[model samples]
Target: MAHFDASRMLSFDLETTSADPMEARIVTSALVSIDGAQTDMLEMLADPGIEIPEEAARIHGITTEKARAEGQPHDEVLAETVRRIKKAWEEGFALVVYNAPFDLTVLRQLTGSFTVTGPVYDPYTVDNIKDRYRKGRRTLTDVSKHYGVTLDNAHEATSDAIAAARIAWKQVNKVYPDLKAMSTDELMEFQAVGYYDNQENRRKYFESRGRDGSSVNTSWPMQD
Candidate 1:
């Protein structure tokens, strides 16, 4: 395995008002910067400007009342979050998101533009690609446990983000060792190809299971 400095990574996650990225608004988000043994984290909560459904609130524990009372406005929070992510990218930190499409797509929709550029590492996609034969669910928590990373508070943004970073670290050592040798731009290109390939594979899997694979999105970063 190639050795890489962990400090040159940024891990991020978002808790949203709903499961559908196009419809949901970000309720909470976490951005973590890792460097060796040192780490910095920023956590933000935003008022989504709509009623948070009970089921969605139960998932992440952020109700509309709590958001309205304690959170920043959506626009301000989103702008600042995008600014931080862009800054991290420009500074050469590889962005590590647990599930890149959901969070990145949501961010793109909220900002009305593509704000996060990377060497973006989506542990979800990478894990799926690396372990296609593994059975059972591949949730972040599941993959983290499989990789021997502790993920406390599964649905919470900060905890999930940190866990994702740790999982990516472990995955690189265990599976995608070549990733360590790639430049940020090259890794971005690699993921762009891998994302679509995985999507096509997933579509075939669903179709083989007699499910509707047509709805599966082939787009990465954002579903077109």
Candidate 2:
């Protein structure tokens, strides 16, 4: 197995206006590039052109007034965000995200023209696959805590993104050591296949429990 370099990865996360990716507008986002002992971080806040809901604001602490007054225009934010992400991909940095589907879906909705081409590393999905029976919660905070990584700010995009990268690094070194052998492209393929496999298993589990399984999405990155 080839040794993986954690510092070479790019970690991304988003804070949105709501829970539903399709309807929610991205309020803030962070992209962090880790290189050796150095780290570069970019953060963007978009006005979203809509009122930020009270509950959502309570969660992330970005109120509608704050967003409108301080955030950049939605289109401009989306364009720059897509540009940076694509640049990172072109530079061959493996993308690490925490619940990638939600963020990727929101990104697609906002950018419309951008497509997610991966070698993506989703720590959420990877953790589920590695420890299917570990109960309670699988949220970014929970996962970080499980991996003994400190997440100082829970809802903030930059903190969450960095924590996710750290958790993924730990998981690779501790749980799925064999994955170290795979190149980023190979890792991406593995994630795609594993996503479908896990979806199928979840569908079967729901069916066995006489629950509706149709809502379970088979797609990775986004549901179509």
Candidate 3:
């Protein structure tokens, strides 16, 4: 079991080179203080082991030339990112990813292709995507609109990560009324077992994509 602390949550997001998280390469990533006081940005040119599509480059501004010129080695950058996140998780921190399925799926995909040094904070994650739809909203943009949070530069990871923190802080308190009263451990337990049905759209997505058949990273918990 695990726990959550508002201050210990690391809201994160990644900007990748493609729409399919399983195949995309992370061009940039950002982690923001759960309290919204400070932030850190890690922008890198991922080798991607493939060509960087022009459309994707236009989205996050990471071109192949730029990556070859200044981006850290892909494996090194990934190892460090996992290391940092794992360090925080070991300290009782829970990561707040807007859509846990997308980012975590990307991470697992990358791990299958490359060597990742440590575990990511997936089990203790709060999925804002699932939460939003459960509340009858359509998208992150819709939830952001409802919460009055500024969503500047929607696709970039840095902006998205910060927005995720603000979103989590806003929604958790609103939907889970006793969030503050629960200890970090209790909060984690609550989120892990929380009950809410999926929207029809998501159910259809899983059906069409055939992605709901089985758990992918079932053994991640035992990884070092």
Candidate 4:
């Protein structure tokens, strides 16, 4: 049997036209659900209806020309995605997001009806909570490396989703075994508190370096 804290976990990710989630337009999104050997992946490309800046396109490799040519309408993609995620959450799967705030905020902005339906877990947030003094960059690539999860495709939505799930699995089964015993809601709350404290700690760290960190979002799963 799979050793995930729950029998099922749903992980999703997105590549968008901007870094600020509130202003971003989705270019690609992926949902990956895993229950033991069975994995279901839904990947969508959306025509963002705006210019995809060169810097953003370079990150996820979804150029404006390609999106305009091959992607589906933004509404169609977001609607289907919302349905899929809601159904999964209703079925009792924990949601895994790498950096939950950014992706969730983007979804919230684009789909007005997309409120997160179930307890959400953020691998990045918990990692910060559990590994506070570890000195390294906390990007998905860096954390996946520390957790020994394979992240061969760095910025791709589908690959990132899978990696997030794997890292969470590692945490549950081995790295942070105590986390498995907590209820999803409890675990989520733990992350929320940890996220807040971590943000404050970061502000202190930055100020110590003669810089300001007050502009960063301290929200847990979503920015607004």
Q: In terms of TM-score, which candidate is strongest?
A: 4
Residue-pair clashes per candidate: 2, 0, 3, 0
Q: Report clash pairs, candidate 2.
A: none
Q: Which 10-residue window in model 2 sums to the lowest lDDT?
A: 1-10
Local accuracy by lDDT, each model: 0.83, 0.84, 0.59, 0.86
**What tens-digit string does per-residue lDDT give for candidate 4 at 1-224?**
21225448889898999999889988988999987689999999999899899999999998899999999998898888778789888877888899999998988988775787787878888888998999979889999989889997999999999999988888888888888778777887798889988888878889899998878678888885
The alpha-carbon lDDT assigned to residue 138 of candidate 2 equals 86
Q: If candidate 2 were superposed on the true structure by all CA atoms, what would the RMSD be?
A: 1.9
Worst 10 residues of 4 by lDDT: 1-10
Candidate 2, residues 1-224: lDDT per residue as tens digits?
A: 32345667889988999998888887998989997788999999999899999999999999999999999997787788778788887876778888788888888876665587646789998887778779889888888888999998999999999999999888788778877888766776677778878999999999999999998887876766
State the lDDT of candidate 1 residue by residue for 142-188, as single tens digits: 89889999998989999999999988888776667886787656666
Off by over 4 Å in 3: 1-3, 34-41, 113-138, 181-196, 199-224
Can you give the TM-score per candidate against the true fold? 0.92, 0.93, 0.70, 0.93
Per-residue lDDT of candidate 3, residues 80-163 (tens digit)? 666666766666556777656577667767766433222223322344323444555445566567677788877777777767
Q: Rank the candidates by TM-score, best first.
A: 4, 2, 1, 3
Q: Could you tell me the lDDT of residue 95 within candidate 1?
A: 84
* lDDT, residue 158, model 3: 72
Off by over 4 Å in 1: 1-5, 208-210
Q: Whole-model lDDT for model 4 versus the true structure?
A: 0.86
